[model samples]
Target: MSPASSDAQWYEAKVPPPLLGLAGLFLQHRLAPAGGGSWPRRAAGLGLSGGAVALMGSAAGTFRRRGTTVDPLHPDRAEQLVTDGPFARTRNPMYLGMAAVLAAHAVARGGVLTWLPVAGFVAAIDRIQVPPEERALHRVFGQDYADYTRTVRRWV
Candidate 1:
């Protein structure tokens, strides 16, 4: 049987990454009420957030087109190792996009302390959500996955 088909432990996060990004947005506002980010920073933030959304959408579309599951909580349900589109750039494009959204918010908030939430989000997803997904993928895809990991980065 395929490793992904096995009854592996679920590596679900208590809070979804998007929700965490939302929390970070709120935290950024709370941390700096008078956030007057420069126009350039705000523009850059807007661009980054937009790009992140596009990256996430492309990755999800890739998964759907390949007939695989996009749910991070159920990596075991994945039927493909998706290596094109955003996957070619980063293994965890969804998570990376979420973190990028938070980082963009932080950038627009205009304070060093406002970045804390972005850091927290990245840390939580990387440490908690990514490892199990990698293991499950490795179990299922084996050497192919190892080869993919060698060629592609986890996050850029």
Candidate 2:
């Protein structure tokens, strides 16, 4: 295999974004006990969780409809530059969805301490997972990806 391919494989084997969120949630549960909160806060958390699920499902469905890979680990396999549906809003909708879910989970847990995991999850995605995928997208889609990046937020 080529060096680039090997590197891609290595990155793919690294910690996944969802695992990071799970780790954060585990830490939150261990270090911070859930506290009491108002009903509005819980309702907001549920709303955020629902929105995250919808966004992820929409993005995945778009990928399926476009005949493209939804696997984040294999962005190099993307056959098309999807710029519609959830992609129109965020360049990384799935990652954003994961972050949103983490945030919602934290909120629902009813402790400010839960946010530590949310922050860690976001940090991992922003620092570790996203840059490689962005690079891969740019390599695959070139100027079109650049234009899309110019218009869409990474996470929104």
Q: Could you give candidate 1's per-residue lDDT for residues 1-156 as a string of tens digits?
A: 654444353454355567777887888888864846889989989999998899889999999999999888778678998999889989999989888888887777688888888888888888877887898888778999999999999998
Off by over 4 Å in 2: 1-3, 34-39
Judge candidate 1 at residue 39 and give its lDDT. Answer: 91
Model 2 residue 11 CA deviation in Å? 2.2
What value does the lDDT take at residue 116 in candidate 1?
Answer: 89
What is the Cα-based lDDT of residue 14 in candidate 1?
A: 55
Measured with C-alpha atoms, the lDDT of residue 10 in candidate 1 is: 47
Q: How many backbone clashes does candidate 2 have?
A: 0
Give me the runs in candidate 1 sitting further than 4 Å from their true place.
1-9, 33-35
- The Cα error of candidate 2 at residue 55, in Å, is 0.9
